[model samples]
Target: MAQDESLRDLYDGCYRRLVAQLYAICGNLGEAEDAVQEAFVRAVEKPRRFAQVDNPEAWLRTVALNVVRRRFRRLTRYRGLLRTAAASTPADAVPGLSPDHVTLVAALRQLPLEQREAITLHHIVDLPVREVALQLGVPEGTVKARLARGRARLAPLVREFAEDVEEVDHV
Candidate 1:
């Protein structure tokens, strides 16, 4: 009964202030309120633990902040997926990307899957050869060989494409 009263007192005393602080951090009144409410629900779910906290308000604030951060991260990932799915072509997928980047992507598609993966991870994704090998579950030497072959195949294709672009520009 005392624990329940303490929790009730904490809620009545801190709810509005916590929501205001969260609103300032999140810039959305609804989200801030929801996060603070969720924190209180969590506290109710663990009354004994909540009672043990030295600063219940700070604990609730941290929980609310974590909730906000998690939602932000999830929303960011969702938006990235939406952007990727909305574009039909690679060039259309990322605006402001250079022509060379588009050309590189097209050239990458022409390589065999293994070589393409190796080159993309090592050069484009900027992972080291060892890291690429680990990700691909292959030997470092294999990744190196794939990168070498991929680069060999791409050089001619890229050079020819660049020459064509240069001629067009000149005309």
Candidate 2:
């Protein structure tokens, strides 16, 4: 198959799953989708290598993950500076999404960085421990430790949201 056509087929086959996995990492639907899409755009620049890859899905995923990781690292470093410099617009107030999504992203943002990445990769993204460790370039035990800590910290935050939901339902 011509490289371009092959890449198109791979994109058609993999886009949805990639976005879902990325959504776990990014905590925002638009970001997840956009990151995956952009990865493919970059892939087109090297269609020959992309076509020669044994597992296009894995290659695409690694590319997408790298993209997200770079962005995460950049944002982590910039978050405080941006907070001070940027406008104080509320995400929920921006419209087009439920308040719950905005709240969830807010809570996710408050998590310790390692914990957030571990939980999202291991749980929400549905990667097994070995894969998570591989993707994170960490020891398997480290991934486990991060997941444990992340879950423990997240429990109270998620519970608070759940309690709010229950109260609303009962009202």
Candidate 3:
């Protein structure tokens, strides 16, 4: 296939899934969309030696994962600056999130990054364990382990939230 056709095919096939994957990792729709777009740009800039790869979907997933990771790292480093900038300017501030959403996000933030990534990819994005393993470049067992542990950790947090709600109801 010609380069344009190949790129088009890759984009059509992978864009939605890649965006979904990134969203699961980042927990922010806008950031996920941006990361996927950046990944596509990078892929187009230097076409992968596609002839050597058996599964292009897997390759695209790997690239997308790397893009998200890099973006996350960059965001971490500049978070202070970003916070300061946001504080100084009310123009771009996002509206407040629901308390339930905020609580869930805070719980997710407490998870180890790998466990959180695996849980989100599996539960939120509905990706199969095998596909998530491939995307994360880990063994299937590792993905399973992470998912199990993450769920175990989250269960109590959710229960605690529920208990707090019940207590509030009685007060």
Candidate 4:
């Protein structure tokens, strides 16, 4: 009971902030929330392990990020299945996605995995180049190169979205 109360206090303190960070990482609030919740679940299940951690927030962040990564990998496999099974175009907005957001996500998906991950971490998640490099287990130079190439590729794809937004605004 004492452990549970302490864990509950930790959750209340961390949940919203973690959700924001994970949202930036994953670009989906629901996925971010789910991943954060899963991380808390793990912490609760292993109170001894959680208690011994030097930095609970760091542990939670790492666990949540890992959950997001694993989910992304699994979703990539299902994406191919969806492409084959669903006649609809991939850009069909999910329940909460604005058309522009859906279009942008679809564009991002066309990138190679490394480039996508690099760009998303550096740009979307707002991590610095060095941090991205560290997280990706690559040299800083490689991260910079990926960012350059990803930006070059994303420019044209995202340009259409910008145009659409402008047209909508004028109309």
Model 1 C-alpha lDDT per residue in residues 8-110, reported as the tens digit of each score: 9999998987775554344455776899999999999998898889878768876876787788678658879887533224432544546666667666656
Q: Tens digits of per-residue lDDT for model 2 on 3-119?
A: 668778888888988886676566667777888988898788877676677777767777887888788778767877767653434546635656765666556656776777778
After superposing candidate 3, which stretches have Cα over 4 Å from the reference? 78-110, 125-130, 156-171
- Runs in model 4 deviating more than 4 A are 1-10, 24-28, 52-55, 78-113
Better-scoring candidate (lDDT), 3 or 4? 4
CA lDDT for candidate 1:
0.74
Question: What's the best-to-worst order under TM-score?
Answer: 2, 3, 4, 1
- The residue pairs that clash in candidate 2, if any, are none
Judged by whole-model lDDT over C-alpha atoms, candidate 4 comes out at: 0.77
Residue range 1-171, candidate 4, lDDT tens digits:
898888888889989877766654565677879999999989988989999998787688778878988988887789887776433344463466567656666677667667867886777657799977867779999999998998899899889878888999999
* Candidate of highest lDDT: 4
Positional deviation of 49 in candidate 1, in angstroms? 1.0
TM-scores for the candidates: 0.49, 0.77, 0.64, 0.64
TM-score of 2: 0.77
Best by TM-score: 2
lDDT, model 3: 0.73
Clashes of 1: 0
lDDT ranking of the models: 4, 2, 1, 3
